[model samples]
Target chain A: MDISAFVLFWAAIFTSNILLTNFLGMCSYLSVSREVESSFGLGVAVVFVLTITAALNWLVYHYILVYFGIVYLQFIVFIIVIAAFVQLLELIIERYTPALYYTLGIFLPLITVNCAIFGVSLFLVIRNYNFLQSIAFGAGSGIGWLLAILMLAAIRRKLKEKMVPLGLQGVGISLIITGIMALAFVGFSGIVQIQ
Target chain B: MFTIIIKDVTVLSAIGSLLAIIMVIAQRRLSNYGDCKIDINGKRELVIKGGNSLLSSLSDKQIFLPSACGGRGSCAACKCKVISGGGPILPTEKPLLTKAELAAGDIRLACQVKVKSDIKIEIPAGIFNIRRFNATVTEIIDYTYDTKGITFKFADGEKIDFLAGQYVQLETKPYGKVKQGVIRAYSISSKPEINSSLQLIIRYVPEGICTTWVHQHLKLGDTVSLTGPYGDFFLRDTDADIIYVAGGSGKAPIKSMLEHLAVIGCKRKMTYFFGARTTKDLYLTDEMHAFEKVFPSFEYVPVLSHSEQGDGWTGKTGFVMPYFKDAIRDPKNTEAYLCGSPGMINAVTKALIEEGIPKDKIYYDSFG
Candidate 1:
């Protein structure tokens, strides 16, 4: 609770990265990260949805759930909030910015079920971070997810040229690369510890 | 504990209501695309509500466009010339449209093209002639063990005027094991002269949703819905000798053509080659033979690829192509119309070409 927003942000990006460290959103992370262009588009959409939903869920958790002594309902309430937020955002974005909406494609609505999105809000609550700290963690985790997927997309594009084993092709090679990247991310534990 | 449960419900419902209110408000204010006008072929204009896809909007206005995937953009059958106001071509539409189509800047998948503003589009003039009809199942004759000639009479005594060899989409209501309604295209076997009634010869396909429903669940006097007169597989105007090759249910369109020829008393030299696996697999032999009697120049040759033992004498034994190859002496002087499976069409086309027929003179409609 005494951690500064700056430290929390960096820690979330490095040591406590949502995708690489916790493997929270592996489905879209693996599927959409095959293309750099689509991964970037999906990353930006996730970042936007995550940051906004985190701030909103934090307010709901504290001002309403805690005040009403129904703190145990946070999980269900958080999911509902996230789903509604994503749907509403999709409608608004589709109406206003048609280009951006199409670029996100099916992935925009898919963010509602993405575990990393729900994970961010839950982490903010479990850590009992203040409002500013929660926002920083949310934004940082989103950036962390974006960075990991972009790196994977670049690697996968390059892997297309390499003579991969027939049995170790496609998602098989991708999972191995992700594991190696996860190991590299584990090295950041020495720089900063969130706990 | 009861009080805690009540509090939880109250708080969650309150939050849910608030979000619902926000969503309703945003949807209303954001999705109101206002009145949009569509100019069709620079001749007809339609003023309608905005925000629906061009395909559904046109279909809603009784302007039917052929779509096989039902607007999922998978089939790519609903491409139309969009003169303006279609916005940018989407990535989903990019793979389906050709480079020429994209370069023309006019073609777009009508199902994917959103009617965001006033737009102009061009459609085939033939699409305007298509109409939906409700008909009652008057009769169902088993053509073979697996094939049936089901006849439907127009409910309101309405007549559908179509070319001889065109097809229609038959719609089957969800029944028994079929969970949802299905629409499947079948060539119209009935003659254009039979205005108030239409017949289709459908071969039962294993696990086919519509076919299974038609074969097993459909009953006489049951009302069926069908939409009409699609396809461009008909006899061309020519004085040349006609060569007809058909197998299985592919005989439908050819039958329609022959019926038209019989009705008009066509004098052109015509050779009809029909193929089957055995005696039971063949249908309409007597009917086709009757046509040959009516028109002396018309010849019916039934070929069996696998003639069984104890089967009575057959006219020709082998695939239709081999028999057709040997019988037709001057392929150059003939116009060939083929309808059947893709394999049969390809084999017969190759055979015809080998027999000195021009490839361009061979017209075919190959089904999967």
Candidate 2:
């Protein structure tokens, strides 16, 4: 509760990279990283959903669940909230941002199952962060996921022509690359401890 | 301790009740739009409660438009012409529709479009007969490594009156991470007279939603949801000689039509050119041979396109269409019903038309 918003933000990105650190949303990260443009679109959508849902979930937990003394139901409540939020976000995005919707296309609905969004909310609750800290944590965690996927997408684009070994092709090579990236991000943990 | 536990339980129940009440309130307040009338092509009118998508609203009223993605707007298959009251086209539907289609006043994806008011739309006349049947899977027989013949019997005394060569959407309950039921279309292989049951020949495409479910998770005696007798692929009632061509799992509707012809005892001369790569790829050979016995003028031609001579194969050795060219010297008086992969259908259709079969005489259904 005493954590500064800036530290929470930076820590969420580097020390607690959602994709690399927690492996919270590997499904879409693996599927959508084939193209930079589509990955970027999905990344942006995830950022939007994470930021909003984190804040919304925090409010629902604190104001409703905590006030009513039903904190044990957080898991079920969080999932429902996330699903509904994703649906509403899809409607709004499809209505207002047609180009983004086209770029995201089929990847938009896949966000409902993207664990990073729920993970962010659960992390905020576990950390017992204030509203501003929760928002920063959510937005930063999403940005962290986006950054990791975009980097992977760029590597995939470059490696498209390269003849990967049969054993290391497709998901095999992707996991190896992700492992290296995870190691690289480990250096940032020395500078900041999110916990 | 008991008091604390009771307090906790009571509080949890109270919160749950409150949330349920809120959801109910939201449903009544947010979803209500009074009674809405949907006028289709100035012919049929449906009066129903509003605030749902036109696709689902129409489906609820027993009018089924072909939608592969279950109103997710991903398939873009459910396009209807909204002559009026459709409002502005949303961005989601723009990619699927053409400028000409938009100019012709097509409004939006029926799934994406909410019917808040009385609306007038034009759906194809064929959709009127589409009904959702509650059928139980009575039999499942393996046709090939990837393909299976699934037969669904109607609930006692319930039967669907559908023509041969029409397709029905099979619904599969979500398994694993999939949380909702997904529906996919399969051409009905059963003849119309066999009204008590429906048969579908499903080939499992790896990672394919419905087919994978049907192949792996589906079982006999399980209730399945189906909507149809949809699609424009059916035998044309003409006196001309019929050339029926099909390959792989594309044999469903073709089989249906053949069974139908046998049942009706039609005496018109017909040749069914079934193409396969090997013996394993071919199925229902006995059924086709049985039809040959029943329909004296009908012949069953199973052509192996890539069969090795040493494999003890005596069938025609070439692509089915070229063999068809040699078989049908004069197609001017022939009506061709072609069903198969897109490549096969396109190549065969072109060859048939070039061989003097009138363009109008050739009907095809392409499986992408």
Instruction: Give the chain B TM-score for each candidate.
Output: 0.90, 0.85
For candidate 1, give the docking quality class from DockQ. medium
After best superposition, candidate 1 residue B106: deviation in angstroms?
A: 2.7
Q: Write the per-residue lDDT of candidate 1 for residues B1-368, one digit (tens) a residue.
A: 89878878988899889989988998898889999999998889999899999998997887878776678888787899998999888877888999999888789999998898999999889988988889999999999999999999998878898998888888879887668787778999999999999999999999998889989989899999888787778888888888998899989998999898888878888889988889988999999988887776888888898998789944678777667665676778888989888899998999899888999999888775
lDDT of each: 0.88, 0.84
**RMSD to the hidden true structure, all candidates:** 3.1, 8.1
Off by over 4 Å in 2: A1-195, B1-34, B98-100
Number of the predicted model whose TM-score against the real structure is largest: 1
Worst 10 residues of 1 chain B by lDDT: B321-330
Q: Each model's TM-score?
A: 0.89, 0.62
Give a tens-digit lDDT track for model 2, residues B1-368. 79868876786666556656665665566556799999999988999887688998988888889988889888777888887777677656767788888787565688977787899998887777788889999999999888899999877678787778888898899887778788888888989889889899999888887887899899998998888888888987877888999888889999899888877878788889998998778888888988878986878899887897578887776787776766574678888888888999889988887788999888887775
Q: Write down the DockQ of candidate 1.
A: 0.61
